[model samples]
Target: METQARLIVDVARLDEDGERYQGELSLALLDLGASEVFAPKGALAYDLFAQALGTELLVRGTLSLPLNCICVRCGGEFQKVVQDRDFVTSIEISEATDFLDLTDEVREAIILDLPSYPVCSDTCKGLCMTCGKNLNKEICACQKAGSDRRWATLEGL
Candidate 1:
């Protein structure tokens, strides 16, 4: 099942009391082709804040999820555990506010923070370049010739 979460806070308008709320969610990472996301779960907590420039809004919350990452070293998948990730953000929903966007900012932060390439295992032996065989699964018996020109020179001497 997909992970869903709800964040309740007095955003856009400044909350004098800085109200807070929390929720649980289950998220998944599907960009990795040959990998699966387990029971990924996390929580969200937020509050209100006021800046020195008089700009006021809600901020301070955490969103975390456990990930089963593929190891590049071993070609074996494993669980990569992580703790809560705080997203201190501000939202502006006022009639004359322009800083009231959170979805795009949050999405960008998550995507950009994702790993570029995930490996199944840490000690994963990659495929053989010459034969294109998976070295991790099995070893290749391709002939390895020692081409040493010094052997010809010794014969002449």
Candidate 2:
């Protein structure tokens, strides 16, 4: 069955077992802002269950989003998927709280799950320090020259 997505829960309408919410959140709404190193390729997708637990609302789900990242080692652009499989949170609810928005929770989960230093591959060769060349793509002239300046005198002797 095609279930309609629910981003905002109707607190008053929630049954004893609660309701399931599944949808894609727009990247624009997140206001993640411009990032030099990385950016969201698309919207953040979520599948969650929201239920009432006494005075609190319990939310649990998974979040995943494709990101275009600049490889930290080679400075090359690459695409990666960031996922939060164990997303869980509890929000205190009240009589006046008729609606519970899940946007904030989703945003926080993604931000916390983002990788600090992203790489294109585990075996990335990085870049040539002297000529600023991507070692993974092509070798630099510096590599053909010598290993180090300190070894130049020893080789001549």
Candidate 3:
């Protein structure tokens, strides 16, 4: 799911009326296939500024939702709560600030904030490869074999 929001605003007279544009926006976190994870309940607030150099926009927001993925250890379906992360992205927008460029910048910020891999938990007990059992759910009867040949001498004695 996507836990990020993108805002596009006119920087003309931004400093004077930026607060007017600042608002809470709701967004949906989608999966890689663009499927919504849960109901749309994310928010973003931003302040826009019309600087002499260029138009500067201050974007900050949070996305709260349960991220669903397969458990790394148990290989089970699980949902992980992803906390809202505040992100600020600065963009130099001119008369030529097109949708594509703004989207690229927003997409980059979200990708940077996302975790590389989602895990069920910090101490998740994975599955047993020998029997294809979820160690977290049930104990497997696989035995550990002794490797040292010298230990065999003691058995004969």
Best by lDDT: 2
Per-residue lDDT over 28-97 for candidate 3, one digit per residue giving the tens place of the 0 to 100 score:
4222222222222233233323232445555455433334566556666666545445644566566655
Residue 7 Cα positional deviation in candidate 1, in Å, after optimal superposition: 2.9
Q: Give a tens-digit lDDT track for model 1, residues 1-157.
A: 5544433343444345655545433232322122243322232122323321245464565544456665554445566544336666654445456334344444444444445466655577776666766778877654132123456667779
Model 3 regions lying over 4 Å from their true place: 1-6, 13-55, 63-66, 81-84, 93-102, 143-157
- lDDT score of model 1? 0.46
Q: What are the TM-scores, per candidate, against the unseen true structure?
A: 0.46, 0.81, 0.53
lDDT for 100 (candidate 1): 47
* Model 2 spans with C-alpha error above 4 angstroms: 1-6, 146-157
Instruction: For model 2, give the 10-residue run with minimal summed lDDT.
Output: 1-10
Global lDDT of each model? 0.46, 0.85, 0.47
Candidate 3 TM-score over all chains jointly: 0.53
Where does candidate 1 stray beyond 4 Å? 1-5, 12-15, 26-54, 82-86, 93-104, 119-157
lDDT of 2 at 118: 88
